[model samples]
Target: QREFTQKKTFTSWINSILAKHTPPYVVSDLYTDIQQGHLLLDLLEVLSGQHLPREKGFNTFQCRSNIENALTFLKSRSLKLINIHVADIIEGKPSIVLGLIWTIIFHFHIEELARTLACTYNQPSLDCSSAVDSSPKASRSAKKSARIKERWKMSATKALLLWAKEQCSLHGSVNVTDFKSSWRSGLAFLAIIQTLRPGLVDLEKAKARSNKENLKEAFRIAELELNIPRLLEPEDVDIVNPDEKSIMTYVAQFLQYSKNLPESEEDLQEKVREAMGWLAAQEKKLAKLLVETENETYYQKCKEMMSFMETFNQEKTPFLPVLSSKRGEAELSEGQQQMREEWDKVVSQINEWKAKLDQMLPSPLDSIEAWLQEVERLQAEDLPDLQDPFKAMSVFREIIVIFKGLMDCFDSHLDTLQSFKNEDEKNMPLVLPEKLEEMKRRLFSNIRSTNPSTFLEYHYGLCSAIANEVKLKLNICDVKYGAKESVESLLENW
Candidate 1:
């Protein structure tokens, strides 16, 4: 009893000292609501102390020989920030700006930090990212995020198969049995690539660092703001056993779409839209049944990750283009214009790839300039914190989400094909399972058990199919880009 009391008192003393010295941003608005400065600072100090260099340069951060002496002094029992002090030696920057620079170390690549810490200090076995969610409607947006557990329902994706590939193979030859796993697996593959992109881990870290209350409140606001009816997050409860026959029914229904492969971008998008509606309905029905059978634990912490994503997309706009712009136009030499133009060339190359997939193209060059302008504007504004790293990671994830998903790209081709599958049914070949008659009987039984009306909600379970289509579209686009390119040689030869 005495020991416990001593520990609590000591912890309080540390908290008070930290709150007195640290900035508010260090303590996320997402987690804390009480506004007790000392407790907040204590949290910041613990979090920051975890960031201290453990052993060598390569272990913790973007290390350097120059920072060695500084690191040694900083990480000593004294626990001072000698690193930030060293960086503050700049000729004309504000003191806050120097502090902001240090924050970037964690934000830009927090995943790397997590990995290192896990390896070095032997961090907890608990997983950081909740799970993967590859739901069809997930491609666009759903109040801000679809949980990872929700995504796990998707099948494994080995490779992306697009309309182009589909045309050369089974456009008219696949049967119901073959298409079930094919479509689900395909969608899973697409979701994984997009989900695993560099920004995702960073975004997860940002969300974790956030105050639960702030994040939950933000979610509540988002629901109110976005207007989702009955917005309480679900928690895990009872698990439902998916009847095998119902699985067969799902597979059989999927094969119907495989009979037709879309040719036009519009056609593909229509199919994607179908998938979106179907998946939403399907999940809704499942959720209702779960509410009846399972406990509330399933989605308790399920804050809208997508909301954080949406918020980040808004924040990261500036820093991306900062390197090339800050030199005033009048002060610009010929070199700066060349750099901007070169960046535009890169953007255009990417657009050309998008056009082939019939996907909407991003503003290529204009967005770059806009991004640059955003960075400069933010640099001019009054920053909220000198040491917060969450903002940086938030910005990183937002950029990836917009560029990889929201930006005009090849996803439309699949959307087009998905929209008009019924029309192409005549042209598409059906791949029936070996035991067609038996499969049909079993499938119907499962369908009955699953409540066929539920599948009806997935609006036909087409979004997952569309998500698959988009993945295939992107694969082909990437292949084309990787095949060739040498401007200087071509120009000289010409």
Candidate 2:
């Protein structure tokens, strides 16, 4: 069932990409069309913008060779293929072919969507230098930006997940954690449509409906209102396990539609400057908040966090439309990139502070599940790479202490759960104790496996190599024709 849907969805998606070529290519039959490997090579070339070598012969060996060449190209990009072989694709193995096409869609389409979300329609390239000042000083400043955009890259799976999560966060109680079961209730789709095109889906009505009903309506509205292709039926997604690939393909269309919103260069630049100013202001406010709350009490920190969240929503929510409108261009400028880096720092500090406060607070059995989830989230986050050893070590020690406290907190909660196990089942959740025990075992296993010494050693090595690389250039500044070169001119040229 899923294979059929993926084939249809992926075929349309492939033809969409191929349609942009000089002489457009279309895949009528996904399984057999690529058996000759010419179309496969064409598709790869179209996706990657890289010319690939292919066999022009009609022989089976030549066909297999072409397929192998495509496989090799995929491998060169560091894409790990599991149980996928050249013979499977050459033979037109249905499942294998579907998997191969899905991989291509995930890599070239879905993964690339995040970076392209900020660009206008038909504008894939993000080099909008003319949108800002093109003076030598501005150019030099642009070159020195923090490269903050690179940090936002994630796997295609994670990119879709983050987009869904961000969209669903605006709606009520629609938490999109993963691609599979998260959309089972169908509220996620509704939330996405409602947020993207306001008033498209009625949340109050959708809430009262059954899963299948909501799923059907969301798909209908998305297709009718947004012109998004109906890639999946209610029965397909409202299942015990919905197909992640199908949902991603369908959701990616929304991202495509989102980037096409009309805005003039003048308006876009004005919005960009406005967003830059807002982010700059936020950086200052968050920096001050971080310092003030550094040694504050748990209650004080909680108060600050709550107040910050309110202020954040009020101030930041207004800019979301413009930010989403020109997301790609926002990170391309010197001022925008610097502001984004500071904004990223602000977010990182908030997470760190939240983790600290969580450790200081106590949790009842009812809220322990939420607490555990938060702890797991915090633990799953990788430590940031700080060039300064002092900064890195300080952060490492603070996190370690919070984690240690969380372990103790978990133990204390576990003991409480165990005590209530013999009590009435109605008053307490029967599965809570077993669930906590399982979680505890996993948490402890992870903690035991983690060696802090290894991290510290790695950090030490990174610190030593911080300034190992340098880009040095010597330029001769010759003032000619009795005209003296200004200091600004020399600095800009330098």
Candidate 3:
């Protein structure tokens, strides 16, 4: 599902939760609960920190591949969270950033379309062609060809990197720079985006040549892969700003975050650019450290960490996780049906649970007790079904834990706390005349059996049951959370 996880945020938390579970359409319902602003924030995290296991072990350079293949059969459907968020943004539907970037992409494609049409015809139309032409300049037969040309020009690869750089630049800091999934994919992406390498035109060819077993793969091969003819290479090309400064030196330095080589002047510039993009603008004064190279230095330590990440991605040794199955499929069949049978059993259990839900709790009071019993029964009926069933149990058990707290003890003395409370509950003290007590005892004797303690426990549990209901009412599960380190000054008071 997700190769990397930063559970502190809502989307990542959802992704993290989903990563540990199975089956589709489970948490998809919670989508409405997540706020629009928070989704954008999590999407930003993916643009920044989502990682992969491209690196094999301890090493200097590390790589992690982006989820270039398969959207169908992931073991966990965590990626769905990303897909939904990104798709929404692309549709010009995101409520935040005013859909500014989505609008940008839209206008961007208009420009790309004109460029492609000119490229395809080998020249501009003799007549001015409006973006949408009433009179077809090209025959209907050639529409398919025009569409392909347009498709080639719209690179997910290029868009993603420029998107990264823009986002980093927008954030004004490169303090958190885990762009793309892995260095391999990131480098390949950069090669196409900035270097104007066209080999990525055919995603299929790129995929075939970039496999783990393909030893012929290289950082620059993207230029030749799709086109089948080597037309460009960053190694041979020189990048420079309008000011006549070589840009390769800058890119080389940026790449050196995971390298130990001496910093090139251009390299230092790139480093500064990326650092400035990712780090907060407030830290601009400290930006010079990116050029430092000596050991025991802060910049050196930063470089080593990048190196470790890069090395990890490149090491896909035998011990590291391998994908022997075909790419793009979430699950690779091992030619074994045993695992399949177990998975089916769990699905059946969940299905049966849905079917018997009403029967399981015939009475409202019974629902609370029945829920706890049902989960235990479900677990006992098939142990494997509950094995890492994070989706079903987390919120479920949180209710159980709250219920247990309500039952263990009641802070009856609380002007604010009580085992039981209602908005309509009066603050007046309990008062009853002896005549009323005698009548109440007589009424209780006639009623035969209702234990207040047990009733109170049941009532408390019932209130706890509605906790999920409250979370639902408030649209809470989608709230984003982050780790915080209390300042030493703040902790001094503690």
Candidate 4:
């Protein structure tokens, strides 16, 4: 038949390629051992793309005899070398075992030979052939093949676990003295295992395994042997701080890194929370120190009022006398001239007092007026709003600090005004009680209520905006993930 001729040609081509690539020692061994000739033939058939040979029918009896002979020869002559070579090949190559399994089923119409080979090396035999008919024998063979395939898969899983352990040992010895290096090497080993057996490395599978006390104890022993660290390294710690920008950056990086960690690592999450709390305490301490410093400065300035009053009295006394005695008719003209001179001196003294007040008080009223005008200009300009919550919060906090500073200054100004009022009442002939009372009321009102109202309004607006943004973000997450549970898991992990 045409199929037979094609197969013969294919086999010849494969033989040529194998003869060119195979080592001379292996070829010599194959030729010297006639009993192992079937092994070479099977390898050549697999390489020649002969998955299911239709011609030159081989029955189960013939296939079993050849397999037994091959097994006996390998056991007697080269068992150790054969084991090493097979392990190395399985580790380095893909689908070789599967191809051999398929070839066995193709020639024998039975799965036992492949199953026996898989058992020899404790590997799983993959079933790669379909039933040719629906006879009772075929049905029984299908059932056996299915069972063998399941066993093979389990064997492969165990093999992968053993390989992972072996790799861990080969990579490095884990101990407290070299925890970081050892741990990193162990992680690399796990990564390799994951690449090889992704389905077996899942947390769900691990949880299932934990149900068996023996397996759970095995895992604990492995963890102990690997010397996995209970605590993170210093360089891995991310602490939230008062520097908002830096804190944001640190948190983002921490969230990203945490995503790569196993979801069951609750202890690591707790450690992160503890670090953040410690950093927050530090920020609180700094805030308290700042408040104390501001208070001390305000009190010190208040105590300097006595010296300032003394200076004011000394400057005023040179121009204004405490009292003027009545003058007789003979001295009336001289008194009138003296009165004009006194008036000129009083005017000059008032001018000097006004200039001194300008320098000392530097009325915030003018600054406030300018600020209001600027606010109006900004409102008219309709500038774009800030998009980031952290940035907006920073601006809001700065505004609150500025407003508080202004309020404190207003309080100090009021204290100074009251001190001046008391000094004037005690030493000067003139006092403007109504004007001072009105100014005091206006300054106190601005300090206590007016500025606070502005602060509250701006703060509320910012909070509402941030809340809306958070809601929008939540909605987007819901849409993307499509389930509340998944969203919660994502956020919790994040």
Candidate 5:
């Protein structure tokens, strides 16, 4: 009972192992067949165990013996079984086949496996027979066994080589140096598997020579393909008006291409150097052009400012009343007091104008001029790094907006001044005449109550006094001219 239980347990264990290790796409029949082939299972267990830690009680020599015994036993099987099953060994569980081959190489140090592998799938074996040792039947059986062994070895080795080639190809595209290293290691491993060190050395030399030639061809192709002159065309560079960035992009691309080329190519290196020099010269030219453009822009702004000033000077007129103290006596009569109060109101308006003018000065235009002067100085000294053209343009644009606003203020001020001037001119002449007529009517009505001559003399004295007051107040015209002069002077200074 115990023996049967152990057998059942072992069967279950092998089944699970095969299921876990075999790819899912492999049919269940393949696993079952491999499981029933006890010799192959035993060999797989031993070979797989070799990769485990020593603590797992792995025996290297026992593993080698197991693999040899498995191959030998497989040789004794029918030719149909050997061909079908051994091919399935490679097709169904290729990783296991590779592991077993690597294990054989590691333990036995044989080279036949790697050699047979390279040509197995495509090449046919010679049917040469060795001299018989005994009866015809025995000799024929021995020859058949040898043929089967050779066939199984070739199939297994071919599977392993195919797997390695696939892996190496994957690594090659990602990193050529790593691919080369893997290739060398694979060659070394294959040499040990086939036990053919001299053959591997020759193969390695041939491969290295071929790789060098291919690398030279690839470099030559790259040199011809990266046409730097066509890439750095003038039309392409003109995408950004001042094309510094475009030129630099072309330079960067050229440098990147040059970095990949072999350093031994002196002609390519010389071309790269010349291209870099040309790009450097182009950069300098662009920088100079930028500076000249900025200078021209500033000059244009200055012209605009000067032209605006000329128009402003032509359009500017004094808006304030020119009041003379002599126009009104220090002791003002009632009507004269009203005139004086109005004059004070005009002065207040002039004060307001002065305040606004004060706020507008060191104006945006003046600020732009100061900024331009600094930029010009930097440019003249060849210190282009110190200038910011964008900032300068922004300031210039703001000054233009501010000048427009100031012109609007000037227009409003002129309108207000003209309205006030019209009011004074329309009302001033009637003020004195109306007051004198009222005084004449009052004096004539009281003539019967006093001496006629005395009353007439009093009326004349009053008339003279009124005339003097009117004369004094009329000097506001002079005050108007004085205020206008002040405004003109302020504008001139501005």
Candidate 6:
């Protein structure tokens, strides 16, 4: 039953993405449709907007090759595919095909859903920008917890659960504790539709209906009115236990499509007010993170703010009104024009903040140069005095440790730069080979062993040699003094 639900839901999901292609392709049966693998490639292309190379022939080898190419692409995305293989998919194995599709859905849709949902959290303002209680304790507590509150992080599952519970709260007995049994009755679905459109779902009628009847009605209304893809069938969800993942995948579309729903004038006005409030809050948050400091905390906050800006750009930008239309007419209301100007300013601020962060965050080359400067300082500094061997040894050890620490920092920074390249090449820092070579040459010229240990050993040897010379000189002076004393005593006796 679970597999049946998954097959239906995943097939609809793929078909929905594929329908957006230039020439729509519908998959009647996911297992057979994806057996040849070209459709699978098309599905991936639509979902990811990436062109995947595929074998065009219908022969067994070509088919297998196409499947292999798709699998390779999935693996390159760092997706964990357990026991999934091209042969299994090629043979039209239902379980393998279902598993592959689920993996795709989890990665492309579920993971992105998690990230998108993060933007919706009403995090406390970074400062006391909003009204606060007049009590001293209240103000102090709010200030004390502001930093922690600003770092808003919530799991996708919990976020979705909260959203569902909120949507169904007014309906009868439609408790959505988890994605599984909570939705098995299908009242939750009706309640969501009813909340979105007041008269769309007759909640009273739905409650009196059988589970299958209610599920079917909800799916029909959603597909017809909302244009949401009917990912699950009545039987798929009306069973004793519906598939949790399938329900989640289906429910998420409601949130995705909610924005496109036609709003009344009142609702649109409310949206504008809400958007303005949200922008004000975000601006306050940005201001807090925009502190003038070179500390590690400041750097981390910059990183977090940059990430938040990315989400804002993707999700919130659509709601921001434009002052002028593409036809060069001022189409927005006065309030909207103000909103647009504010939005533009916020966008400009984001760009400026991002540039500041990029410059402040040490690039790989910058880290290397900084590391070389430190090592050079160590090289030029005078070696510790051999008179106190213990202190000298301690100083040498400290310098060596610093060298090792710098190298470790450089490696970590380089890895971070490489990751930035992988994630987005445009954001990657430029690395020039000539400059790197020059730094490398300067570093090695000052020491041998090609390691920090070489610096340690050289200083250690120098300190030992100087200590031995000092000891020898002291012994010789003692001998000479004793001889002089003996001669003086003999002259007195004569």
Point to the candidate with the largest TM-score. Answer: 2
Model 1: residue 162 alpha-carbon error in angstroms: 28
> What TM-score quantifies how close candidate 3 is to the native fold?
0.15
lDDT of 2 by residue, 321-353 (tens): 544333454345665455455554655565556
Better of 2 and 6 by lDDT: 2
lDDT of each: 0.28, 0.63, 0.28, 0.33, 0.31, 0.62
Q: Every model's Cα RMSD, please?
A: 28.4, 16.3, 32.6, 38.5, 50.3, 25.1
Model 3, runs deviating above 4 Å: 1-227, 233-237, 241-311, 317-331, 334-494
Displacement of residue 371 (Cα, Å) in model 5 is 69
lDDT of 1 by residue, 367-410 (tens): 32233223223222221221223443344344434433422433
Candidate 2: stretches off by over 4 Å: 1-5, 18-29, 49-62, 72-83, 116-154, 265-320, 323-370, 373-380, 383-494
lDDT of 3 by residue, 323-410 (tens): 1100122222332122223322432332332233223322231233333333223221211112233433454455456545543322
Model 6 agreement with the true structure over 224-332: per-residue lDDT tens digits: 9988889888878776567988998998887676545554656656666777777787787677767533454433555566456545543443342221111111434
Per-model TM-score, in order, reads: 0.19, 0.54, 0.15, 0.21, 0.13, 0.48
Q: List the residue pairs that clash in candidate 4.
A: 124-152
User: In model 1, what is the error at residue 328, expressed in angstroms?
Assistant: 55
Model 4 whole-model lDDT (C-alpha atoms): 0.33
The residue ranges of model 4 lying beyond 4 angstroms of the native Cα positions read: 1-357, 360-393, 409-416, 419-426, 429-435, 479-487
Quote the RMSD, in angstroms, for model 6. Answer: 25.1
lDDT of 3: 0.28
How much does candidate 1 score in TM-score?
0.19
